[model samples]
Target: MSQTSHFTKVNRRDLLSAGAALIGAAATGLAFEPKASAEKPSTGATHTEPSATAPNYAPPIVQIQGGQLRGYRDGKTTVFLGIPYATAERFELPKPVPPWQGIKSAQSWGPVCPIPPMAHVGIDEFVFPHRYWVEDEHCQILNIWTQSTSASAKKPVMVWLHGGGFTNGSAMEAYAYDGKNLSEFGDVVVVSLNHRLNILGTLDLSAYGPEYAQSRYTGTADILAALQWVQANIAQFGGDPGSVTLFGQSGGGSKAARMLHTPSAKGLFHKVVTQSGGGEVLADQDPAALLKIQQQIAAQTLANLNLTGSDISKLKTIPYLDLITAGQAALRSVAQANNQRAGWNVIADDNYILRQFCDWSSDIPQMSGSVFSEMSSNYVKSIDKNSWTPQQVNEHLTAEFGDKKDAIAAAFKTSFPRKQVQDVLFFARPNTRALAAKAQAGHASVYNYLFVYEYPVNGGTTSFHTAEIAFVFHNLTEPQVRVATGDASEGYALQDKVSRAWINFAYTGNPSQPGLDWKPFSDADPQTMVFDTVSECRNIHAKELIALLPPPPAPRF
Candidate 1:
């Protein structure tokens, strides 16, 4: 079973050209500053124009931690961007980024971290609209938004991590990820960040050199470092450090789950929300089997490039383009050999990554759920050009489930009789139940949901994996969605109800919104909020579905 070659499967040069076009749109004008020299709150400050650079952008300059900070007022909310938390070295583990001089304008969003674009392959569920552009090592930064008109309204903080499968994506992708809506709508301060990824972030080489020893989990370490920075500096931006909530969708949820058990992130956050995401708990193979492939790739890269010394500095000096080319080649080789899962996955490195990620936070309260047809429906959209037959769907089921193929296929056939074979093959029979089951096992005050508000596509494509993101961010009419779904406001009312529920959940442990009251999951009923054209809470997946899905293993961390 060879790994799919997403790299060479597409034309690299053409993809890079498309990538360059995306980078042009990535630049945004927002900013933030450290809060060293704090300023007292002025309740009724007039909105006056500052200098030429900040004509329409007028925010009170607050001093905290020996640094002056400025925030811009947009409508009823104040927004900030590009706040530096930690400074990372070129291809080095993240360290404390030094404080800057004077008032640093956090008015514009910073550059995104680097990754190659999978352009040849058409868009799928996870491919966001942002450019897959690469940037410098100084890419570690955060964005902030607050609804407090005064500088003294200490609001609860919601820290977000953008999902790109630990490879590509940033905090500045869509306006939906922006803090303005969350801050104003929920009356809470929102913060998002961009961190290292792919080979630059997750190439384990500890078995080779001491320099590589401390660099095993560089990507996760970068996230932990970012959280630590928030703890030290969020209070300056009118955020409560003691009441920070960490949440994300898809890859972001996976990162959040990893942080839940990470020793370094013990007290950094108090609440967790994982939507349509799970950690690396699949019980197929051991992590060490994949790690060996990464070490071999690194060794081959050094030897082929003729770098004898073990110092990473020499490796760092290599040109960016060359590194990308070599990394792609390494990935292709791994895929062809079917060594393990593709390159740069989180490995269980004894210290940082204790065990396969499982839901073991029974002691603490947690909220978890996924879209009803997350991976299943997304697969249908991915292979729209080709049609699949029932035999084809059954064959795929055999491949994916091995000994349990017949039961899984039968379940999908019985559950969705009229669905296309592609839908049955991809979305109708995925591991969505496993995600909810894993979380429920931990006794964490867990809640679940099935986002069923189908985005009305022309033919019969329903709401897919990422359909709720734009709505949750209060950007139902965003440029991206408008382009995809012609009828933009079809799900507007549903969006309003669901987004508010998410914000309310972030504030209190419950998803108790103004008009909607969602019950938390329990042993007797396992309450789930099904967000359709009209929202309601109930166990949509019947007892048969639950019985078909096996129970998840308890977390070992």
Candidate 2:
């Protein structure tokens, strides 16, 4: 690994400016990359960024494991997009990219793994805008943002895994997924990748052939391949391959935690953070039985396609949509028969992943958290939570929670004394205590957070799903961010605190900073960072509330 000789310092103001450029580019739906440059980089030198008010086209080029490639510049951070990390056939292990004859143009995005056609953008985009690309099966690609392309500038690498369960979503799906700002903010190399998803990556074809021998998780395999690529080439992109932090939200969080139980991913990452998605998946049942059910689903998928074991080769050429639709139908049939919900689940047949992520001992510092409002009472449409009369609160809570409404209301009042009675309808559920305890038992320190910041939209959505992403990315300058959090100076200050906490966590194991002193969470002292204008550590009421209601529904993709 190369050593750092010259450093380009990025202070908080510079960080904020870098992040501001990111969202505007994302909001306009334009690719943030510029034309590739053929110029080679100086080994070690003080590199200054161009002014943000103008577009400075100082494209950067670097040599990596595959070969020489080129990237572009956006103010302080340099960027490279659509770099092919690996390639794989339908339901096969990822194969590393071969050495190329010449420089590959990484200015544009590569094809995304094929998923069901997405519906038109809804109101959700108002909170989290998106970027779309064409789809393909061989979609093993990665993107990079860094302070320099010099081999000697070894910055920390933060790899992001995207959400959409194991079924949908790509690295470039969300505007907030942009990395240039975060890279500058933390002075680290930011990476995000595109991997296989849904049935194409999880079909249990191993029973019919040896190539598919691993228990149904080729989607995660694609991610593992991306990590391997980072280990081999990130240093050339000014990243410290050994100092990697795997972080993601929703399904992406589960993906990051999944790496904890994966033996192969052991040295690829040094730390992890999961937002709003952790401990939802665990392998506590018999591994053999899990594999058995998976194989049954695979067989049914074959039957739906009118193919037999001898005709397994036909799967490669089948239309992508026809294949996925049939696979989903087969999964539903099998899951329903077993009195289980339909979804593709990997068996713990692989010894490396025998239980929930982080259930075993390790020094790896981890953070897990969720928003206060994963589901809004606005979904009910019958009650105006913002203007509920005292009688309405009583009548509505009774209808929503039945006879336990009184108990739930009291618990809500005790937990959130300042919040309105209607807020209980959307606050976070008590679900992470078990995971915290499990990790603590193994001697691992885990930090928890609850984002209750209210967005300005709809008289204050308070805290909807994915509300914290922009704040954590320090992307409040985006017009959409203004729509979500309003033009409050406090929003800027909150972004600084939140984004800094994440950056500090990436550098050290702990997220504590000068302003906010965060603490690790465990069952004995369930301390949580309740993020808002007045953020503080407190014991929560979600546990008391959970006892008053029925079990929460299974996750949806």
Best by lDDT: 2
lDDT of 2 by residue, 1-557 (tens): 00111345457578898788788789999777754797656688677887665543535678887787888777787789999998777788888888898888888777787776666665566666777777888788999999977778888889988877888889888777788778888888999999888887778888787777863778878889999999999999889887899999888887887787787786888888998775654655577777778888889999999999999989877888788888888988888787766566544555646564543337677888888877553522433477778888887777778978878888888877767877877765746853674565566578888887776555566676677888877777766566656778877878888888889888887899986899888877788888888888888756776777666767542
Please list the C-alpha lDDT of all candidates, in the order they appear: 0.65, 0.78
| Clashes by residue pair, model 2 | 454-462
Q: What is the Cα-based TM-score of model 2?
A: 0.85
What is the TM-score (0 to 1) of candidate 1?
A: 0.76
- Per-candidate TM equals 0.76, 0.85
**Predicted structure 2: clash tally:** 1
Worst 10 residues of 1 by lDDT: 1-10
User: Alpha carbon lDDT of residue 405, candidate 1?
Assistant: 63
Off by over 4 Å in 1: 1-57, 121-128, 131-134, 149-152, 282-287, 303-312, 356-360, 375-426, 430-443, 483-490, 522-526, 542-557
